[model samples]
Target: MPKTLEGEIAADHAEHPTAANGAGATSVRHDRRTSVPRAAWLIGPALVAGVAYLDPGNVASNMTAGAQYGYLLVWVVVLGNVMAWLIQYLSAKLGIVTGRSLPEVLGGRIRSRWGRRAYWLQAELVAMATDLAEVIGGAVALNLLFGIPLIWGGLITGTVSIGLLVLQSRRGPRTFEFVIIGLLAIIAIGFTVGVFVAPPSPAGMLDGLVPRFADANSVLLAASILGATIMPHAIYAHSALSRDRFATRRGEQAGERGATGSGGAAPSGATGKIAWHGFGIRRGTDVAPELTPGTATAVPTDTLVRATKWDVTIAMAIAGTVNLCILLLAAVNLAGVEGTDSLEGAYAALGVALGPVIATLFAVGLLASGLASTSVGAYAGAEIMYGLLHVRVPLLLRRLVTLIPALAILALGFDPTTSLVLSQVVLSFGIPFALIPLVALTAKAGVLGRWKNHWATTAAGVAASVFLITLNGVLLWLVLTGA
Candidate 1:
């Protein structure tokens, strides 16, 4: 939500040149900050959002696809990745345009007190559900690599992840972004090596990219893979992240200024509500007036948005490639191997088929995904809560809140990998809550102003949402009927 400097702001600045509240007081400050753009700033948000794509849930789901169905369901993974690109792009756009995250917009729209509370509660549940896969996934990797028990491994994961968040917090968002990007590299490297160790048949892999299911059961499995790949909490999280990362300098942290004698209340700028709404932008305005600190230059908002598109495209391409590799490796090395549908079975099979070293490398990738994605899940939880409640808490507290469900599952001694896969199916059920709202809100001119969603974008979003909903319905019916 970028705010344009209007006549009133300049006039106010002229009258109260020293007034902290005067937009004029900040005008020169902005002019000094908007000069140069960095590659890190441009691409950081998408890289952070892309972490969700490489999490443990994806590992289990993609592995299951390759192991159980071979290359038959690879198209579903591609479809889900495309859906993710769309979802993340729209989410980032909403934040960049409106200066408000999706949760903030949703909070503003939900007028009823109880209704907002209900939304918050449901979002919290979804956040916890999201955390289950990440936490369990990392723990499974721990067990695989170090012989740690599931419950203990989960505890270790929660503790280490929280520490990472706290450490990253001290280092600032730039450091955090680089850390996640580094972990993504770890994952990408693991799978790159995996491809060489157990390459899929060229003809079959190509055919797998075509949209066809081998059987009805594969349809159910495709739904599962699709659901696992496109995250619910991620949409909310990405918008907030983009809003934070790409926002103007002093955007939300410094509230709008006012003259001391004026006795007027300026909006709380916390969390980048530049214009409060991006709809109906003033005519002839080229960019947001507020400048990001560091550049003594003024850049157009359109350019900023264009930079975001580049970030999304590049980051998502890497994510999609890594995800495809997961399926390919599974299909080639472990899919038809007896019992390889299980994570443990797959690990053992990988050791037998390739070597223990390759299997361990796979576990290393899983470990990295588990650790990085859990941090992201916690971020999404905090955003959802703050979006609805407007309260911020310590990162550790948020991490602990999100970890409750994962800890409970571990305490019960459930199978870690099984629980992670089931958590993804649960994740599928929560998509509509986040996805439908994103599509609906972004389509409105009131929210996006000149940045309103394209007709084709809206159509595709709705179509995809409906398809997933229908697939979820089919899944539910089969579960109830034991089909």
Candidate 2:
């Protein structure tokens, strides 16, 4: 596929800093420079990746999980988080080793034009499905908070989220992370109140953390949890985030004379740039500097990978804790309540038990969840679109396009809860498509050199991928047969 113009610009701005001699091209140098301690590299991409786990999809899915099963499916959330950790790590590793995202690498590897086109089509569908959950979550949050109807609430969500994106463009990813992390804190506070107000039996909740579903519906819901938790788009987004944030600057001085990486040259107009920072007040250096001139630090590939792993683990662990908290609160307060499968039902039930003031806290959390996740999903979509199709659209235009499916769902009068659940299931299906490629690329000695996946690491990743695919397929079968 040809690179889009914005893709070329992003590339020029990102990859060519030292290598292009002012012309934009990817510059790779394999010499030692400066290495930072693992602790020093802890703050950027991994924190951003964790935001995917805390989105409104997770809120909705966990709400259902806790209310229906009363902590019985807490194990599923745990499982989902574990899967997310593995998948995200592998995705990020692919980016560091090859300095390209899983989707971009697929663009190079798929070979046949038709095959690549087919991949793009499916990936686009996945992105839209992703947006569906996020948009609905935000809209539902608005409805809950202000008593608006779902339709108008959705429009409001769209407007506010776009405004936030424009703000994020100006503020930079660090600001975006702070905003997301702050929203996550709101969710945690909401749950903290619920856990104290309606604490479940500790022993019982612990038992619930073991992997057993109460029935077939639990199985179907488990898939939704995986979709919301593991998150297909997150895998692609993490790889790109890590690659761009921590790429090496080794031997950059030599590149000042105009040299390119062994990946070689692109045809004219093929040098696509992604206008990721187009709306930002700061230059690319002020945002992600590893890609810009004189900004990246040199380190051994293995050390960089090691530091990244620790970073991913800590951020993802916090995310997993948040998912668990969401499930725990629902189980304590709304589990088994009649008609509590949806967010509103749960809210009403809580209002009855805890009174309106405390119940309103639920809406506050939901609004935060919705707002953060909606912005994130749009950004993830932009990342995938650029990586796969090498195209760039205005941020609002990108946000608007992703909103189409969400609007259609509302127009056709789809049940918001059911639509959210189904959207997660759709995300589950996209996992293997992303994971299989990550495993293959990471295991290639030529691609990663010494940083390639060891046999044990490759085996683990492949096993996890197979297990995820099998479980997703089983969930699909159960849903099809209405089991």
Candidate 3:
């Protein structure tokens, strides 16, 4: 069965062309549903990889691990990136083929009632807990950069929810793209500047990339990196974003076209018979229509080609390089400090090793990462609500959900460094909760239609999932029993 919103939109459009069509015959709103061409799939990961780098939880994880172990933990980050790439590619393929996100596909299409409720509850908890980290981390960074009290910063960060909501409502999906790109640039520049001064040795850097098993923290930290990279939201966000680029029905056609020589239908005729699918936008509205329903009315091949794999791959590589640079910077500057357990300690040590100006820049980078990641987390939370409940939550309300924990964490007084570590732990703990369902959904041919995972892909995905689950389990056991 189609979702309530998809059904409602489809039925209403079928019933009332005039309502969907606008008062003036001069312009008409194309149906939002349509198949997308080959290029549209790139949009999601390109957008998400940027946001993932800037996420506050990720910063904390990278910063803390870097400070404590130096470049010794670089291997964990490398492995995490490789694993995340595999998972996200699998996730995007699932969406492109099946036309539904992981949660809904698992809940409504594939699972039993009990399974649906369990998955929903689990995903919701992960979303809520994840927001707390974003809010608190952003607030902490604000405190460091602006000299504002943590409590006030939390209040200010909480208020950011209103801004995010406004962006979502007025700017629509493009707002997400704009904010993520800007933050990614900010972080990239900061790392570049920082690394130029305190570069890691090539030998040490290579060593860092090798997996370490010398300590419990190393094992757990590796898990945290993987957990952070393969976030629950990335799975859903990738699917939703892909839909925005292409319609499910025409995805095969677009793929076949891209595979063959049909780069795009012979450019729109002089009569404009081949207009771009999901291309038109009137001023003042941010939400673009999905590509599938509208591809019938336009030239999707050209427009989608604009959102090519090269675009996404380049963006992911940049984000990955930037993330690696930040870890290298921390390893170089703060690795020797016995007490450098927190970002503040790392910042203070950076000021000594680099300079006050460099330290200030680090703060600026941290702040950018926090705010960017916070927006992604908040957006994921709102989208999950829309998909699960069939109604969108106001951005203002979602901000409150983020702010409450931020304010409490700041006001009640937790050690900022410790808090950062715990946030990474929380993210790690949540991974198995997200991954098991992802594996199950991908493996089932009936659920994914013709887009189901191939035997080799399923084997690889399941193997990865089980290895991660066991890794997470061992970490949990060690934490509990102090082994």
Candidate 4:
């Protein structure tokens, strides 16, 4: 029989005696409460995960959409971001409540060995597709800025990502978060500055929000935009990031105990001690009171969840705004310009129209986006392998392996922008595999316990899933029939 939440808490506490005594936990909690700046420390994991949203695939897709369709697909970007906020919140909630990533949860639930392997196979492919976009984007940026060969540029991007991953592994998650967030800041400045220099027409922008498509090609760009924005890897990465960020550690319960008073009584509520278990929170006398690792005991489930919402909101706002700015910059300036649909062309045009400074900044932003996002993508891929396959591969080896496809694409002289847009389209097709399982799992009371999704949340997830699947279907039909 499966162990109950109470049993898990007892086992966890037994493994860490310091947690029960509250000896080491109090000072750690106090430091967290007193030392770090409130807003800066609290908002992180989402920002790291949000890097995936502003990846090279996003720039390629959005820029292509703007240059080709000229504000016609603004509704797609906005709608995808709206859906992304809800989806990301649920992913974070699952991690905080269950103390497991989406991949880890699915790994345990699938039951069949073959079935798990099959799921992992598709997820791994999706992750590879994500890497293809980021590495290529970075490579293209390097080529634009320094006149390097695409292959060498890809190799350099891959090398930098491995270094970033090393930083993540050695320095711990918080340090990694800080580093990625710094890159995110650079990405924001690089991508959005051009918009101020040449803003899209307000009337045209408003029209683009009406939810209509121009043609079959427009449908492809829409799918690519959605794919780039609401990424499968981001979904996988956020849950794990949340799990790692909020996992209860030794003496964490002491912080909560400290919060209630010296006597360690439950605060205000009539319930028993607040016990955090592996699966969910248990409030009663029956369960052993314990806290998990990584999170402070003083931070309760409600507080962490609230913080997560803010984290996700801020991250999404930044990602969404940058993505929109990328499109609008192109829409206002590059639309109808010959050869402006590609990243290289776009770079040249921006230089010609807006001066070399803006173009240089644009390349710099793309480079940052590629670097930060590829690191996060590699992280997600690692988590997916660990959670679903239950196998551990060195991050360096995984980075090398994933780099092959992107490097080959670059070496073969495939158009980087086209490859990026198509990679996102592949990511679009993979969305249902991640989204359906996440929505279904989070909706179950057995999974999240009291934190299960509300009816409306479930409905929204279902609607988003259906819309994305339908969009992919239309894209497939258009391609096959040459619509």
Candidate 5:
């Protein structure tokens, strides 16, 4: 077996015609240089994945934290976001270096079929919980905005998500990314504008930054916030997103080379070039070369990894800011307010204290969060199933199947905000299952070659894992003991 990722790539390349022909050596070298997009163009994947952080689950958790605890859990949101930056970067790096997602890697590694099925069960459950939160949140948003019934609103949300998934399947990843990013912009504006209108007291905000929890309930909320901020599905989705963005198709490369007449520049839609709005962001038509069935792309691993860092950083910054803004908006305006415990309650409270416009924006943002996140959650669920079981279910079928749980809850008349918060807690329980594996795999030199995590990186990953697992343990103890 090949020892490192590059060795594996080289071994895979040995079978290709270009690698076999000595005359094609120069062409291969030129293709490697031209096929790698500049760092700036590699920005969308992480941002799209980052939307998972700003989902309605996040809005509910953060809003509840600030309203109930009055900034006590602010530290949790910040810490979670900081950890998310590292976790997401590692995920993106793994995909950029290895050309496989976390699930794909794990699926191949685990020897037992039962073990893989068991793992898939947990991941599927987590994905369902995610869908539940997103759908319920969307339902609540629609009800707040237009007085639509929760059941009907849920049906609408699920239908719209199917449409979004169709957009992703039909239009290609770039167009899908552009649409998600546009929704992300709307989410940012909708959530953050309220904070500027009624800024939290600086002293209170700083005090809230201190690491302390009031009680067992506080710990639960903290866990919910962390779960919402550092999502398991986002981790799974980011790796896949990065792999899709960077993976090069050899047939496309050869076709582009032939069509360009050898010496002429590749056209706007050539293999390496990613065109947006009728213009190419990168020079070449293709992005990178394929390594193997499940391995790294031909782009220089270091360059892609570096670009992934920027991508993850920018993504985390936006997600973290929007999350903080949500908490702060509630902290300043809704703390001690009776009706602010739920999203609808919060919306009504915001209108009472601020104005109708601010409340409307909050509802709009929540709607965007729900719509965007449910779509991404569906995508992640599909990837998870494909990676673990190697089964390819139609996206629409999966979306409809997943929507049943959320719609059922809404139909049963469960509190939307409570469901959202509890769903995040379920997500928190799932964090270690995804996170520990990611950390362990990325630390392995065999998996990532020289791009494997350095000792420091591994140590940080270990620390994060320990912290999260410990928190979950504490939460379990508290809940069981009725603390």
Candidate 6:
């Protein structure tokens, strides 16, 4: 079960500042010397966006967009990535600077009675919408693979995902990371093999990257592509991941003050009563009883910074390359190559061109992506709900909130083959709704302090937001007017 944002914040406050204990003092001192790697920061966006690339819904949407538009909408993915990079960077920077995640920060800052209520309402909407997509994507994959009824699949997925939530609570971070990484590897292998067997031409690929809006259908597809890429949960995930790293850095190293205090008593400045329920803190004074001229010191801050950067950079490189490869695979092999002109058509093409086995592999990749992306979405929903309302709803309940819509879709007996594609479009429509707060938070120096966005970053972020809003609006108008 996930704790409410208030509950989490309260728990955090109850924690005794590591600075107070002797080990805390040492950690603070060590923090001063530890330097983060230059590359660590780059991982922030990849962690938020990479798995999303694998998202079943995104795969469906991108494939469909490619088939319908014949590579012309490749610009949408490129543009979405550009926007994702800017927004996620802002989220990471904000989390690092404030020592707070997006939801937590917003909870503290938005104090108006009606305004707060409205924010919570909107957040809940985003959560439900995002989760709905995940549930549908998973169900679609199951239907594709085993011929399970879509409704049955949705119910099963909801149950299994809840179990995963419980397991996550007990599992350590390293173990969880390994699981996600392994899944990513399997999906990557599947997609790469499919691409290698039936590659697209380089010339057509070049043509796909250029922007064109020749018709209403093309524009809608473009909007859907962009909307699906920069999802709402991702905005929240970016902040939370940054906070996790920040907390780890703070815990292992030292306080912000110049004092050397890693393992020690809580600092007086820090307001918390951390009970040693499951975790332990080392005393800072034990590092060296007396400062000896010959003693070896802990690593410097620059090194910690560099290490952080390195970690982020490696993650980014791996995630970005995988994403680009997946996009290429679709653009070359599946995009209007045959009479097929939709995502399902692309899969049909894969079956014909590569084989049934390859098509099955694609389905597996979609399944993996759906499950992975949804896990993050669940966490993000819990965070937002807690942040605004301070209620600790169980993970199963959150999953249910998302699962209902997918289940409904199943009852309709609709072809789930297209569910993945539609889910991305749904996400695209929801992006601007969630991103507005994120951009506002990052731009305010008061919220971020020294971590405020630079002019270039701010410009890019604002521009992305404006573009998304306008594009979504235009698409919506076209849909409503039946133009």
- In angstroms, how far off is 342's CA in candidate 6? 6.0
* Reference-based TM-score, model 4: 0.84
lDDT of candidate 3 over 37-113, digit per residue (tens): 22333354456444664566667777777877888878777766666665666555555545445554554553465
TM-score head-to-head 1 vs 4, winner = 4
Alpha-carbon shift of residue 325 in model 5 (angstroms):
0.7
* TM-score for candidate 2: 0.82
Clashing pairs in 4: 247-293, 248-292, 248-293, 249-292, 249-293
Q: Candidate 5 has what TM-score?
A: 0.85
Q: Report the C-alpha displacement of residue 245, candidate 1, in angstroms.
A: 1.2
- Tell me the lDDT of model 3 at 324: 79
Best by TM-score: 5
User: Which scores higher on TM-score, 3 or 5?
Assistant: 5
Query: Model 2 Cα displacement at 360 (Å)?
Result: 2.1
- Residue 48, candidate 1: C-alpha displacement in angstroms: 0.7
- Poorly placed runs, candidate 1 (over 4 Å): 1-40, 214-216, 247-299
lDDT of 5 by residue, 1-483 (tens): 443334434543674556333223223432232123355555789999999999999999999999998878888989999999999999988877666678978988999999999999999999999999999999999999999999999999999998887777666677889999999999999999999888788898899889999988899999999999889999998988887766443333343344432433334444533222110122343333323322235544555676678889999999999999999999999999998889989999999998999999999999999999999998899889977887778666788899999999999988889999999999999999999999999998788866788999999999999999999999999999989
Models sorted by TM-score, best on top: 5, 4, 1, 2, 6, 3
lDDT of the structure predicted as candidate 2: 0.70
lDDT of each: 0.74, 0.70, 0.60, 0.82, 0.82, 0.59
Residue range 267-359, candidate 1, lDDT tens digits: 343333432211112122122233222111122345446667888888789989998998888888886689886778888988898898889
Off by more than 4 A, model 2: 1-41, 247-303
Q: How far is candidate 4 from the true structure (C-alpha RMSD, Å)?
A: 8.7
